[model samples]
Target chain A: MSALLEVRDLTVRLRVGGSDREVITGTTLEIAEGEAMGLVGESGSGKSMTAKAIARLLPAGAGVEGSVHFAGTDVLALSGADLRRHRAKVAVVFQDPRAHINPVRRIEDFMTESLRTLEDVPRAQARTRAADALEEVGIDDPARRLRQFPHELSGGMLQRVMIATALLSRPLLLLADECTTALDVTTQAEVMAILDDLRRDRGLSMLFITHDLELAGAVCDRTSVMYAGQVVETSAADRLHADPLHPYSAALVQARPDVTSTAERLVAIPGRPVSAFEAPSGCRFAPRCPHALDSCRSTEQVLTGLDAGRVRCERAATLRGRLLDPTESPTESEETADA
Target chain B: MLRFLLRRGAMLVATLLVASFAVYGALDLAPGSPIAALTGGRTPSPEVLAELNARYHLDDPFLVRYWNWLTAAVTGDLGQSIPLRENVSTLIGQRIGVTASLVALTSLIIVVGGVGLGLLGALRKGPVDTGVVLVSTVSAAMPSFAAAVVLQFLFGVRLGWLPVLGTGTGFADSLKHLVLPALALAATSVALVTRVTRTAVREELDKEHVQTAVSRGLPWSSVVRRHVLRNAAIPITTVVGLTVASLIALSAVVETAFGLNGLGAYLVQAALNKDFAVVQGISLVLVVAFVVTNLLVDLAYALLDPRVALGSRAS
Candidate 1:
């Protein structure tokens, strides 16, 4: 009820080899008003697909089912003018800044194109507003820069330009799909700060998708961890760091490189990330989870309350404090018993 | 930019010079003399034959003769046409207007009309796209000569709606006659432009910028005009340039079929009568046209793709 964007049991099936294979299976998420939700997952884990489906930007042949309700309006049912209005309201800043902006067009042309075309904003006013938007995103010499093409700018600068252009429509929800992934470490932090500042200043809702756990924890109000195309666990950003509910979340936390760790080797996940097809009939992460039991492999997962947000696990209540020290190796006796 | 253009200009000069040498050498090695063509191949006394050879520098050494022609060509003297009994430049020059007009019309039909259809086909995917593909494939498969014959049969003989030969008298009348020939010349290239342009537009449409534009609430038409077409222009320009160049040579078949006294027809006649000066001069012009066409295509390509243009300049 508190959410601005509520994706209810959304499922996306891609046509692969003449059959519809569900890439995102009933994945649900919500972003509250003026709040940022971090969607963290490895590549092919359906993080992008979920965001694209919500934005109605899925390619032809992608079958989308389930309801996506934004501001109490059915997102899936909107079309024509309503759909365009929805798209303008829900702006997306993609992963690669260069990939998403026409290289042939000047920054001014790109920034003012939508505003002038869609809203009938006067060209001069649009240009002035574009300059201001650029200035807001820490871009200096906005006037001079606007005349330049995307290739003329650095990766970070191009990303800032993208953000500036994205804000021209004055969207309510900014879907930043790894907007800083292609940037260097320093630029990534700057872009994230710029995004955070803009979100707070404009009172906007954001769905910040990225694989960087630390970044998500630091920037987002709440974090949702996806596995095999489903949100395995979602909790307050701070709580996700201190105590992750699901095993996959815990494993992801353990795999993060830490400066203070005293272990001989870094903790690694048991296997490669799985696609929806390779996912099991039961708990999707059961094969990779170190704490998996015989029953865990055979039973379907359901969301169970853990903390501020829900987790997809059967024994969530019982496994409370036991999953804390995820990096600690199993005892010799435990390995021998399994053998 | 100046440096790039200068380099291309230099390349043009070098190519023309090389072409002149090839044209000169090939004609020398070719059988039959300019004497036979000028004298109607009748039995001539040795003294008369010697006089004609000396007059045309046919008896001069290869290097001296080529050097002489090269110098004269640079000064706008393209040698003498033995068959037409006039300056090679004047003979080709008079008909240059006709051929140039034809080639320009064909290029227009291919680029504007063909690419417009291509864009429409790409924008509308189901039946419209299928129809465009089917039409383009059929057009591409139809040879220019066969196409000329077919167009003549349909429009000229049966319909009597158009002229079957000649460049016509006035502008409008000329255009009337130009239709079938232009269509015949344009068919393959129209098909080529349509297919390549459709592919280019489709590829550009798949790019994330198009998606970005759409997501920003811009209509697909606006997105296509602003983003997709601009990005697709480079590849389409390349195909059009190549097609035009190839069309220049292929026009000979169309010209002979229609009995037009254009460069293509002149070339065929010169080759048949062994009018080496006219043949050599026309060949040089065609080579220069092709090179210049490609050069312009490259320039246009650089404009569309700033990476290559700006990157080289930046460094």
Candidate 2:
């Protein structure tokens, strides 16, 4: 399928003092029609910012430069009523649903208001569609739930309601930015399952921004790793774990405790995560990578496609065989596995 | 909701009872008795004085006298004014409209003008904000009597737009006469309410729900109307409610300055003459008005935000 949303060379800068500070570098990514792509990173990696930028929802005065093409139209170029119509087709579910839902308003008003007023759907018709959307997200007795306020619902339930509210507008793209991060393990699993089923059923494209690599590996069709405002690697979710070309992606996959690994201690990546302001001149990860060469520090890194995915490391081609999979514990039986 | 209202009603009764005791105590502790005021400063005969004391229950303890007064007051008999020789309640009843009208008009301006300016400052946030803050600070710092004098000089004398004296005869006339005093009374409140509303709206603007509403494709107008206004109402109502007592105090000074025959003037005259019955009666009414105004403000939470109003029932 053709790309449903294409974000090319997107950069976001916020004016902090007299000067502009880079929040997101020139990051490029895409989501195909009916595809679920995961943008994974540690805190302050600009994953959520990327999701917001895609929807053109940045706060006023934020300097945004890039091309965001959705269904053959430039999202950044749309203005007036066109922008309003464009926003309706793109829905976002943020972390902490309770925080995003107005406490003074009932769930029904919060859910149906956009549909009735913005979408120009009739009240009764909006209510009907809202109920159906709620049911699609696995919420039972939606009519009763609608009358309750945000404080009345639990965190997990509120998250489901948020998802349901997003789907009510029949958005072409759904942006879930750390949506399940605030939920518990069981509730997180439940929410993820619901999202998977709903996306497949509706053929809706989704960008799931998360920090949990394992979670992304489980639910996403493809995963893109972000670090200090740059996408370092993009590959099939399962393939990323078994063969990560970027050293940062390799360290991340190895950090997760595997149920199958017999090793007791996990390998820790040295040094702290850098902010955009603290970024180095070349190969963003060179300072921390164990395989860094002098060239890695002198030359800028560019994403080069190899096999089924892309990598940004300067030595990705030469180091491919050696970087087989760090996720495998040192003591695990390599002979027992099929190559 | 019914239970919440009932509980608030009971609290109001308790508040009024305590206020009545304090008012009655101050009068009882004062130098002369109501009978002394009745006698025009002359000593009465022993038999006449004893008969007066017995009939009026002036010889009873303070609490007993308070109970008698309260019981009679509740029955629409607030006792006869010593100086006026008219029913205390009746005197106040006649003048309540004047003061109520003044207060109502003043509060309307304070709420609408203050909140409107506040929203403008918070939404626009440049010269409009600076102007609002400067005005609020200046007016808030200015005393009500001083404000009254300046308003009288500028609007009443120079402009000759409104009457400079007595609470006018009819509704329109009275309202016209009340304009100066109301504006004077509203100045400080306008200052207070505007600051409160501006802060509230500014805070609400930063709330996540506001951003969420915009992302939902709601227009700027819809997002502000649906989210910002209602959320800011809570803090604004609180500021307005708490200002009632100060507003009452301002009315007394403003009424005297404007030479309006309102209940505020009645209160000031009664206090100075030590007309114990009128003083105590008006004091009790003022206390009750303050309490009831607050109760109504509290009840408004039920409509503005269901979370608070439904708090007791939901739990």
Candidate 3:
């Protein structure tokens, strides 16, 4: 499949207070036509920044480097009407629906505003379209729902409303930025199911950002694990879950508690996560990697092709099968044998 | 909504009653008596004193006297002004129009200039924002009386533009006459509203819904108008309402400074002459204005914010 969106070496520096902080550093990823790509990371890992950069929604005074090409157009270079047109093609559904919807405005206004303002659709036609969109999201009584304000709906209903609103413009790509993270578990599953069904039926490409690895694996075709603002690994979603190549990716998979078999404790990656600007020199994950060698600390890791996937670790070849099992500690004999 | 309004109306009546009692009691507790002011502090003959006491019910207990004043006030008879020798209600009626007109003009200036400048400052940061902040801070710091002196000197005395004293007879003339005093009265309030709106709009701009609106590919202007300003309206309305209400009280200083024959100026003159009936009558009117203004503000809050209406319904 051809790539619908290509973001290469995109580095973003935000001017915070007086100093400039690099939020995303040399991040590269792509979404193929009709593909769902999951971006997995901890908080402050720049997943949301990447999505914002693609949509041209970065805060003022932010400095961006590298290219974001959407359907042969340079997204970063777009301005005025062209920029707005680009945004219309890329819809975003944020985490907290309550926070992202105007509390005072009715659902119809929130949903139909883009159609009415951007496309100049008539109010009556827009309202009809909004009701249809609400129905598509499994909301009953669409007519009544459209007239209700955000505060009148529950969080899950509001999220569905937001999803329905995102789909109104027939966007080519959907940016779901932790869209289900704010919902209850059951509601999360329902919203996820609705999102999956919509994406499949509409052939819409998506960049789904989430912290939950299993959730990403369930809905995404491919997954990219981000660490300190860089893509640490990109591979088939199930394969990433089964055998994660990057040390950080492997650590994340192992951090999940298994329901099939009981473990004494869930494995957690050592040390706190660092932002791109605060990351140390050389390998950003070297300080926390359990399999790090002396050379790992000195060599800066770049995303290099290994097998059918990409990984940033220098030791991916030797440590492939050994990283998954939590019981087996890295032994000196294995290291000597590899050497 | 109807129930909420009815409850508020009842509360308003209760508040007015308490306020009237306080005003009457405080005035009564003052060192001098209405009898002294009526008599010009001269020793009266025994029969004359008896007749004066009998006529004004000066020999009645405090509660009985308060009840008498309250009953008369409720019926629109605010008793006779001892010093002015005029009906208190008639005096208030003649001056009320001037004060209302000044207040209306001042409110217009405040809403337009304040919201406009505030939106400008918030949307265009850097130098314009800094300038707005600086100017508003200075103006807010300056009291209305001080603003009155400066404005009167500059526009009235120095510039020889706009009238400085006496409310004019007709609409155009009255507006022209009241301009300086209104500016003086509205200066601090306008500054206050400007700062409040600026802060509120800036805060609303940072909210997630505004970001969502911008991201939806709606025009930037539409995003600001429909999302940011609409969301900011509640707080802006609240500040504007409070400033407008307080203008009734603060107008006294401006009226005195400009020599306008408004209710505020009449109030000052009455208080100075120890005209108890006039003072009480004006105080009651001021209290009623305050209560009714607050009621309107609450209703405005319901109109501006659906959440408030919903919450009130739930309660």
Candidate 4:
């Protein structure tokens, strides 16, 4: 399948006072049409910045570099009127709905104006479409909701409203950056279910950015683990879950809470991710990786192609060879492999 | 709402009582009595002094004198001005219309010009924001009298575009004379109002809802006008309410400097000549103005935001 969106050597630099420093270094990735890719990282890992860069939404003080090819057009190269036209095909949902909603505006104005931006529909027709969008997201009585202020709605409802607004544009790519992190767990699950249903029904391509690996695993078809300012690993979701090759990815999977297992103790990653300002020289995760060698400390390991995946580690090939087969249970591996 | 009004009314009565007492005490403690001042620091004959004392209720105890003055004040029968011998009520009546007009015009200028400039400075950002901020700071730093003098020199004396002093002309000409004084009074309030407005808008700009507007492909103009300004205006209303009373204080200085026939000028003249009844009458009017202004501000606060009313009710 051809890639729907290809981000190649994307770099973002931000100016402080007069000096420029890179917020995101050269990074590359591809998303096939109807694909869902999860970008997993802690805050300040440039995951959100990358998603924003793709949407061309960074503020005036920041500079972006790279080729973001959406369909056949270089999104980063689009300027002025062309950029405004391109906005109809792409949409983003922010992390907080309350912060994004206009306090004085009724919900109808917010939703209908957004629809008007991409189409020339009459006000009534646009409002009807907004109501339909809200209905699709499970908001009851959209008519009553359309008259209320942002403060009148609950956090979950507001987020759902934001999602509805995004869906109204019929965007080719949806950039959702930690969209459900502010929500309660039950609400988050409900939102995720709605998003999953929408994607399946519309075949919408998405780049989902979040710090929660479980959340990413639940929704994304493929998961890319990010460290500092780089994508360190990418693997198909089921394959990655069954046998993660990179040490960082393996640690993340192991850290998942096993609700089924009656184990008395839970495992966690030992240390924090390296600071972005002083990102490690070689493999970015080498300092935190248990399998690090002297060569791991010296070599700048790039994401080289491996078995059905890519990993940025000097020992990923050898580690893949030693990985337990999918047929083998973890209980058997626990007897043979050392921590 | 009724409870809010009741509470505000009680506070108003207490504020008026305290203001009355202070006025009575200050008038009574003056070096020479109104009687002696009227007699040019010369002692009158026993019979004349006795008649003057009884007419002014000077022989009564301090509290009785206070009670008499308070009663007459509430009844709109404030004896008479010692120097002019005109009824204090009539003198106050003559000056109030002019002062009220000036205050109303100045208020309109502040709301329209000040709020507009503040919104402009906030939306423009960078140098435009900095320039407005700097100008407001300078105005806030300079006293209202200095502003009045400077404006008088520029617009009145130097340009010969407007009259330098006096405001007893017809309404139109009074406005022409009132311009310099009004600008002087409004400068400080406008500076304060603009500063508060800018701070409020800047804060609203950082909120998540504004970010949502940006993400929706909305124009910056629509976002600032609709989304940002309304959210910013809630706190700005409180700042405006506080400025109302200070506006009168500013009016007093400007009116005196420009020789306007307003209550503020009457106040200065009364204090300078120690005309106790006029001083007491003018003080009572000012106190009532302050209380009424505060009541109106509370009402405005409730009207602007239902949530404030609801929250107050809950507590």
Candidate 5:
């Protein structure tokens, strides 16, 4: 299947506090039509930045060297009405529903705004559609909810409202930017189920951005793990979870506390995660990688294709099966193999 | 809503009563005697003094005199001004129109100029924002009396465009006469409202909802109006209310500078001459105006933000 959204060599530089800092550096990913792709990373890993770039919602004075193609249209080059249309076609759901909704406006107004203003739909008709959308998201008494302000609703309900509003534009791609991170676990599962069902029902493509690697693996068909603003690995979601190619991805998987296993301590990757602008010229993950060779500090790393996936690490073949084993260090494994 | 109104009304009455007592008691506590002002600083014969004391209740205790004055005040009798020898209420009634008109004009200018420039600064941001910040800062720092004199020199004397002295005869001429004074009165408040509005709007624009609004593909203008301005209205309204309420106090200087025969000017003259009755009456009226203006601003809050209104209802 042809990719519905393709982002190639996307680099974004933002002017923050009077200086230009690169936030996203040469990140590449693709989502096929009607397929859900997960972009998993820790905070400051450029997951949100990539979504904002696709939506054309970067802050003013931002410099973007990118080619974001959605439905075969170059998103970066679009301006005026075309940019607006692109925004409508690609919907984004942010993490905090309360902060992402206007407190003073009624939910009806928030949901119907795009229809009323952009499509020039009449008020009553737009309101009816909003009610219907609200109903689809499992909100009971949709008519009353339509009249209520955002503060009147709980966070989970407001998130559902946000999801309903996102669906109002009949968008081709839904960018879920840590949408469930702020909710309670139960609410998060419910919202995730709603989103998954709706995406399937509408044949919609989704770029689910989150810090939860397991949750992304559960929801998305394909997953891409990002570190320091670069996509380090892309493969089947379960495969990436089971046999991650990059050392950083392996560390992330191991760091997560597993309920099924009796691990005594959660394995933490040493050192703090660096932002894209602060990353070194060589492998961005080399500083913290346990298997880093001397060459890993000096040589440039690029995404190399292997076994139905891509990984940026130079020693992917040598370290393939040994990544998941926590007991054996790289040197010990090499010595044992030689013996 | 009715409960809220009733509670607010009771508070208003209590506040006014306390304010009136403070005004009445402060003048009573002053060193100079009302009798001295009444008698033109001359000593009267014993019989004459006794008669004057009987007429004015000068020998009554402080509480007795306050009760008598308060009772008569509630009945529209504010005693007679010693200097002007006129009924205090009648004098105030005549002068209230001019001050009211001046205040209304100044408020209009404040709302329009302040909100407009603020919105311009926030939305335009770079050079325009800098210019607004610079201008508003200078204006805010300037005293209204100094502004009054400068405005008088520029518009009234140098340009010979507007009349600087006295309240003019008719509506149109009166508006013309009041323009300079009103501008001077509004100068500091306009700057205040502008700074508040600009800050509120800029903050609202940065909110995530505003970003969501943009991402929804709504027109930029629509997003600003529906999301940014609506959310910013609370703070803007609060600052506007505070500044406008303060205009009453600041108007006294502007009125005296421009020589407008308004209540503010009358109050200043009455205070200087120790016309206690006139001062008391005007102070009561000014207090009422301030309280009523604040009450209106509170009502505006209920209208602008449903959270306040609905929260009250829910309680």
Candidate 6:
């Protein structure tokens, strides 16, 4: 009835070369019951780091501090049996299916083992459930597919298997980190559609992390734009596209190419993303923002907004009246915000 | 596969031919004649020495002598041992059973014990495991001869549980004498195999698939044997194959220690008495066994892992 997963004030730091390198800065977000949230950011924007933190899959060197509340359990406080029980509730579908499966194991055995292990189901029951899950993920001929090995299957098919294995647990939250980035365009679409259908059918919430803003907007109910390890803006998927308050989000939206529209050249962001160790003191995006005032350079902005959807921008006051209509179709004729 | 076998067979034949030449050359290089050795370095009359040399084909030029020996070898006639006054092949045939039994037992000890202890140490990863690895490393560091002497002192002289020497007693009793030698021979191999298995297993544990399994909440044991162990086996097979050559060489020491009438002992006796035929036969047998064992190991690698056969694309 309420939020399915809530992440609050999450920060993760690692000691690298005698310095405390913060990989994920203080960021807060939530996914409501049966609602999907897209977290869009470039490679070093801490999107994947945040997802791994939520799953408690960080390497040994990492130090995590935050409360990830999923299904009323404080994910950080849970330990031992409590932690394991909560982990079973939040499943992760990694990017590479080959690295995620037992190479020597047949697809059927691997799937059945995964299903049985997470749920404590009997072997025979697990096998039946695995086939059913594979079918749910739109794999044709589930029986034969199960018999095949990971090496024998295509990347898209393997990814679907990973998704099926994750879905078999009936998890409340699915953390998918660039799950289709390694596949071809056609395979990506097929896998995405399968995921979309599975999410709708199961009424599951997903934290879909990716670098593709268009794909995120197309699939997510809400989108959170992240920059250099902080959530810079959050709005309804359509609103974030039309009225991007944060300069970083605006740059991201501006960078996307439109096949149906016309632009002399796609405007790319000026610089590569700053490394986690070199994150700026003030607003991390301020250096790149053309609208940055003296205050934007001197002081860090806090995430503040009247609605749950917020933007960490000091220029929010000036930008509020200029916001575009969320329902406006993505056409070049729409208001350019011209900032 | 057929092409591979054909190439291997050709190479094996060439290697044997080269090896035969080396053995013949060594015999030809010996300082004194067999006639002199038999006559205790006496000045044998020219007619008598010439008659003996002609009988043994020493009168022919080196190439002709070698060619005659080669053709004679093909027909299982390796001339005769002057000192023993016996057919060279019959002497070898009589002695080969003892040598083969010794080599076979030693090989069994190495392959079985080494792999078993290695798997154990890798899995346990405790003090006991550490102890096994430590002992193996130390044993591997020592030469087989050194290990043989130490084992002989402990088991043969002090323990008095087994026979002391010379393939003593009945077949079972002779086997009992071989046990200590075999154990000594296997000691290093066990250490090596265990280390290999442990390293391979530990590395496999860190693989992403292993983490994926853990994330699924599968029991650790199932993850290891079903996934990690099988993948770890590829490298271990390579090491095992390479070790066979050493294992065969180490058998020489074990055979000598027990005074068994094996190839190593026969070769030594033949060399001392200037019995060229016995020396040649022993060398040929050793080289053939070494090459054949290597070939078998390579074949096993192909069988145990399809990736090696399929050019790693299957991986």
Backbone clashes under 3 angstroms, per model: 0, 0, 0, 5, 0, 2
Q: List the residue pairs that clash in candidate 1.
A: none
lDDT of 1 by residue, A1-339 (tens): 389999988989998889888889878889989999999999999999998988899887988888899987899998888988898999999999888989888999989987898899998999999999999999999999999988899999999999888877889899999999999999998998998898899989999999999999998999999999888999999889778888888888878888776778887998889988668988999888876777788998987667677999886665555676645555565445544
After superposition, the stretches of candidate 4 with alpha carbons farther than 4 Å from their true spots are A1-4, A16-19, A71-73, A78-89, A103-135, A141-148, A292-296, A304-310, A313-315, A321-339, B1-6, B28-32, B49-85, B108-130, B299-307, B311-315
lDDT of each: 0.87, 0.85, 0.91, 0.81, 0.91, 0.79
Per-residue lDDT of model 1, residues B1-315, tens digit only: 888887778878988888889988998998877787778869899999888877777787899999999899888889887767789998888888878888999999999878998998998999999999999999999988999999999999999999999889889998888889989999889998999999999999999989988888777677788889989998898888889988788888888888777999989988998888899889988888888888887887788777777335431
For model 2, residues A174-262, the per-residue Cα lDDT tens digits are 99999999999999999989987887889999999999998888888999999988899999998888888788998898777778868
Order by lDDT, highest first: 3, 5, 1, 2, 4, 6
Regarding DockQ, does 2 or 3 come out ahead? 3
Candidate with the larger TM-score of 5 and 6: 5
Tell me the tens digit of each residue's lDDT in model 5 across B1-315: 787788778878989899999999999998887777778889988998898778778799988988988899999899888667789999999999999999999999999999999999999979999999999999999899999999999999999999999999998999999999999998998898899889999999999999998998878888889889888999899788978888887788989999999999999988878888999999998998899889888878887888886236432
**What level of docking quality does candidate 4 show?**
acceptable
lDDT digits (tens) for residues B19-39 of candidate 3: 999999999998888878888
> Which one wins by lDDT: 1 or 2?
1
User: For candidate 6, lDDT tens digit of each residue in A40-61?
Assistant: 9988889988887777767667
- Model 4 pairs whose backbones collide: A99-B208, A99-B209, A100-B208, A100-B209, A101-B209
lDDT (tens digit, per residue) of candidate 4 on A1-339? 799999887888877678876777777788999999999877788898898788787777787777899989999888765776566577788888877777567788888876675476798899899989999999999999987877789999998998888888888888898999999999999988998888778999999999898888889999888878888789887677677878787877777778787766666767787644568777777777766776778888877888777888777775674443434333535434533
Q: What is the C-alpha RMSD of each candidate to the true structure, in Å?
A: 3.1, 3.8, 2.3, 4.3, 2.4, 5.7
Model 1 DockQ vs. reference: 0.65
Cα error of candidate 6 at position A127, Å: 6.0
State the TM-score for model 3: 0.94
Which residue segments of model 1 deviate by more than 4 Å? A325-339, B50-54, B310-315
Clash count (model 1, backbone only): 0
- Regions of model 2 farther than 4 Å from truth: A325-339, B44-55, B309-315
Candidate 5's TM-score: 0.95
DockQ of each: 0.65, 0.70, 0.75, 0.38, 0.74, 0.34
Which parts of model 6 have CA positions greater than 4 angstroms off? A17-20, A72-74, A77-90, A102-105, A115-149, A168-171, A321-339, B1-82, B85-141, B145-203, B254-262, B310-315
Clashing pairs in 3: none
Weakest 10 consecutive residues of candidate 6 chain B by summed lDDT:
B306-315
Interface RMSD of 3: 0.6
